[model samples]
Target: MYQYSEFDKQFVRNRAAQYRDQLERNLAGTLSDDEFRPLRLQNGWYLQRYAPMARISVPYGELSSEQLRVLGTIARDYDKPDAALLAEAQEKQTALGTVPVPGTNRQVGSELKYGYGHFTTRTNVQFNWIPLVKSAEVMELLASVNMHGIQTSGNAIRNITADHLAGIAVDEVADPRPFVEIIRQWAALHPEFVFLPRKFKIAVNGAQEDRAALGWYDIGLQLLRNEAGELGFRVQVGGGMGRTPIIGTVVGQFVPWQQILNYIEACVRVYNQYGRRDNIWKARIKILVKSEGQAYIDKVEEEFRQIVELDGAPHTITQAEYDRIAAQFAPPVLQRQPRDAAAQQVHQIIRADAEADPGYDRWLQRNVLPHRNPELRAVVLSFKRLGQHPGDCTADQFDAAAQLAERFSAGEARVTHEQNLLLPWVHQDDLPELWAAARKLGLARPNIGLITDMIACPGGDFCSLANARSLPIAEAITERFQDLDEEWDIGEIDINFSGCINSCGHHHAGHIGILGVDKDGKEWYQITLGGGDGSRAGGPASPGKIVGPSFAKEEVAGVIEALIDTYRQLRQPAANGRLETFIATLRRVGHEPFKAAANAARFVEKEVA
Candidate 1:
């Protein structure tokens, strides 16, 4: 919601001009793919599985209606134009399969057509095309919208995320949006922090629910009310997921709100100065935190803080400035009315048709949350539905979502870390119409934060770092658990899958975690249980215990199923009937039964074979 100032606008424009020149040189054959790759990557462009995919950073999943409109325009004008090419390729492939032609014009054309366009994560709107020719144009358009692709890739400070419900959530002690925005502005072109050994991630959580997934960030800050009743942040550092995933350490306690920026600057300086740069694998802040010990890190951080405080606090932010930034994020004025009548009518119809309504009902219950306004609500449509490619959104779909956001949701939509779309501020009066529109666009899935809403990564298909195919495995699990009613009855359980140890899918933070690994060139998975994000009443759940070494790909879902059944049998009911309550009950009982069930299932399957 932050508006770009003249300075901000000029900065992006200059970056665009620079990229345009780089693109022009590459196109003229003055620069090769090797040279262009890093330059393009710095600008959020990638050569993906299909064509060249361009990823535009939304910066912590926050966007203005106008900025989103520009994104939609880009998708429509630049990417979707390849639809004709796709159709032609499909026709040619069909022909090639039927006719036994060694060589043909149709075949050649088909090959050319197939070479164009590709798939991308549902959360990232990717443009698949040659970059050099249109780089200048893309730059110019993006600049006009006050956008740039800086630091979206490489070892730079990747996207900084804050709770999507930062200011909106009633349970928050303070809104951390202003703090996140300030950090974003300060870190954009910081000289010392730009080129770390590995990527650095930061997440700010203002919600009681830990929507930012604090346990998985390089640095996670939770806004809290100090004993003095003043706003402050509790700092957690070193949390990361990779080959050697580790939970973050609490390096700092009760950092005053006014000095938040200075504190962050100090923290980064500590990491920048001491973090390993020689070995890429061992270069993350997590490694530093682990090697140095939290006490040592805390001592260094205190010294850094003193130095920063004495050095005039370079990135110091004021309450007034904070207010000015916060003002930009004011919620839209909503109309007062009863819930959508047409949607209610559809609800009735679905209720009458038990089979159809059951799935939708489950989806609505889990995915939809009430809007601040009386007559409206927000819907979080989980694109992370079981075996689907998580966070993959097509160019046309991007444009369509943008259009839909503009029409019904105050021209704004949000992308969740869970790899889902949130149609925030939808009017209840328009719910039916919006639902129909979303259905048409295939964005109307009702699973928001359920087991079926599993987070996954681009595994063997595209990632050079993956050990196996995560998407297909996730799909398999989703298909196995296709019964929505049963899933809802199971309640709020997180079943996160990671293709490899990197854990981009956040397997370490899941109540039920599945991690993909390699065993003698064959795909295998490891299961972990009882982990969670944020500070819960029983103190945050620790990293899950690994249930076994690994299991064959075919046996992964069955292992999960067996664990769930064990959990259900052992669970003690909570007052609200939530799964979190059940999980707490199960955690108290320990992992023996779950492990036993999983091992027994594997043993039985092996005997049958």
Candidate 2:
């Protein structure tokens, strides 16, 4: 909810102008694809398999209702708004019974109206379309809305993420929003940090729950109070996902809140100067941490910290500035009355009509959350379904969600780290009517926190760096395990998939993690069990015993079935009976049996072949 300052506005406008110039040159043949590749990438443009894909950063996965409405308008006006567009165009062309003459300037049927836009697990939005001209138009439109595609796809600093619950969650000791905003401004287009060896990500978490997924970032800062009651951040460095996945090491302890930015700048300076640039694969900060050791990285960070501190903490933020940023994110006002009777009536109506509504029960459990205010509830809706690409909500769907939030939920919608949309402050009494409306918009799927609620990366489908197509495999697994009751029985599980070791889908943090790898030009998956997220004693799950080199795509469901069955037999009973508890139970039983069962499925397939 941070409003763009005049400085921010000018920054985006200048960048837009520069991009327009670069694009025009490329179109005019003044720049070759080789020359334009890095330039376009810095501007968030990519030429993928199907078309050109542009990634727009949605800083910290937070979007204002107005900003979201703008995105919806772009999708509707620019991209192929519906799947039926292509099919409908084909039908009309066939009706005409002949191809249109090539020289005619008149527009043909459905001639590539921009590209489809999709959300990624990394707090970014991507637009894919052919004929780069339309994509540029989309970029210019976004700039007018105070948004830009800068640094989203490059080796430059990517979107800065913070706890999604920042400012709203009462448990937070101190809001990290100010620090996040400060870094966002400083890092944007910083000449020293741009064009680093590899992509860099930073996250700040102020709550006990680690909503920012601190362990997966290059720089993870956990804001906390020290024993003396002074606010500070515990800094973790070199944690990243790629070919070599690592949970960051605690490099600096108790960096004072005011010195947070200085410490971060120091860390980046060290990585920028020393990080490998010769081999792209070995260039990540994680690799540097591995080769040079944490002790050495700590030494460099300490040196940089001293220099910055000596210069009177160049990035030190004042209390008033912090208040200004925090004020922008103040929680919306809530009604004091108890649950409205009319809302309860609607809930009953939907529950009673279960026979007529298949999604009703799922929506009730998955999409809705209890609020401290008796009259109000928060609705958490999953965009991740069995066959649909996870996190890919259409523009119209975005607008519909925004409208619903404005009408029923205090004019706000929250985007969750799990790639779901949230109506955070809806009145409990409105649940039934809200559910009914959400159902019509195709936002009523209720598989949240279930097996069907998968986290997936674009994979080989779009990303040039991926080894395999992750979305298709995720769809296959979801379809293979489509029974809602069975999924419910499995209970609160995190099943995450990544196209490669980068773990963009957060495979390293799932209760059940699946990572895609390339094996002799064939797509293979590596399964790791019992990973968890957050700041609790349980962090990223330990790398489980490798289950297989490869398994038939269809056999993945069977492999998971065998693993789940192993858990059922081996797990010790727990009071709450959560999957995490079951996983802990299995850890006690050891992983050998689970690995044996999962690997057995793959072995059988090899023999059949």
Candidate 3:
């Protein structure tokens, strides 16, 4: 985790003050709503259906104990701690057949205290029900902990993500933290990128596992140590999911580490100059790349060359600067213990005993993985459960997570793109105590990358931009798949639901993607199949292929059941995870088999007539 410098702290404080001034002017009627919209969005204030949603950046998903405590403090003190009491008071008034009047006990009801910390797939934290007037105070609180909301909302290269196990992964070629930070630092409030064609996203991955999902980003960079022993980035571009879903294309095969920043600048510069600006629907850089094809590539290369040709080139990184940033991310020294065969045998036997506890076995199977250091392990703190919203946890849980990190590992935790927390340096020998501690804190759910561990946005529940309520669907799916043995048997399936076509769920990459659409004021879900990551490097990630047609909310679970059944029946026998099996089965069986199955399921569901 990189700490903020004095300059960084001052910059954030100033930005908060600046936003405060803008908000005050807007409130005073000096600036109209339209005039103030961009200002608010850039500051992470979105006027949702119910209230303002403030998204705070957890830079690269990194959070120190102090930072996590601050987030909990904000959620506790400002968001209101006694939401249940307020709700009870409201209910009593309602039962008495009286309207809860304003400036009375009703004032407490309007406190809007039920909100919790929401972790997004982009690795940011969102606080719903934040009032516009209190946003500046939130920003000031965030500044105290080296976090901010800039580039989180507007059309800018949003927060840069990297392999969640950046420095600690077993098979990583390099640590992407330094480069990711460099991008975040340089791109922060870059003048040219203020108003691009649309919002942009970038990801960096150095792990052999490609956990970052490189193919689904605006710009995905995979770090590589070539035959010559020099590390550089292999660039992919144009890929995004929304209404028009497409996997990114490789723009640069291998860019030198020194010139990677400048190359990225060139790519965005090209996008900024000529990307569509007329129709909001086609405003994305993905549209431009798809429209122009090779010509787009040519333009980017030319721009990059021009940039490289310039005197004292902009976005150029000096060796000293790179080294300085890299030093901040250098892995800590840890005692190395021999991971002998006997030790493994002992662990396996001990694990089997631990598995006697139902949830403990699932915890071992799902939430735990070996780290690069033989003595340590990476522990995932799942926010997904039967009734819980994906990526959501209480203020107390946040504080407890920080405490766990301080006691068990480093005094830091990392957020995942899947909306979970990661203790990256927990000792393997301490799994029992860690699991017990986390379970008590409500931070352990033991469902990671399974069907029940769904991805969803706030949808119509909060966001005005949504077409339907996504959380209910997610909850339904989780309930339907609550049986642990059956879930494990079904195996690594990804079912992502998006309220609308904005595709915040990354539905395009789910094996079974459900997109909620408004059909004559009713919610209808369009299912997509065979959506997933590339099986190998340099291959396109599988974009969600539409099955047959949309299904009503009631038909969703059955439709998914049919799709899974199709996969179970047709998949070639292999030891691959169920998602990979489903993808492979789709490739071999094509869309027809799944479509036929879905249609048959829908027809059967219609009957009992």
RMSD of each: 6.1, 6.3, 5.7
**For candidate 3, which ten residues in a row score worst on lDDT?**
98-107
What lDDT does each candidate get? Answer: 0.68, 0.71, 0.79
Q: Pull out the clashing pairs in model 2.
A: 115-129, 241-502, 242-502, 339-375, 343-429, 367-380, 531-541
Candidate achieving the largest TM-score: 3
Please provide, for model 1 over 8-69, each residue's C-alpha lDDT reduced to its tens digit, 9 standing for 90 to 100.
88988998888888988888899898999888888887764323556666666765566666
Model 1 spans > 4 angstroms off: 27-38, 46-53, 64-141, 298-302, 305-309, 335-364, 371-376, 384-387, 535-541, 577-582, 603-609
Please give the clash total of every predicted structure, in order: 10, 7, 0
**Candidate that would win on lDDT:** 3
- Give lDDT tens digits, candidate 2, residues 394-419: 77777887788777866766667777
Q: Give the TM-scores of the predictions, in the order they appear.
A: 0.83, 0.86, 0.89
lDDT of 2 at 606: 24
Two-way lDDT contest, 1 vs 2, winner: 2
Question: For residue 316, what is the lDDT in candidate 1?
Answer: 64
Error of 3 at 499 (Å): 0.6
Kindly report which residue stretches of model 2 are placed more than 4 angstroms away from their true locations once superposed.
Answer: 80-115, 333-365, 370-376, 535-544, 577-582, 603-609
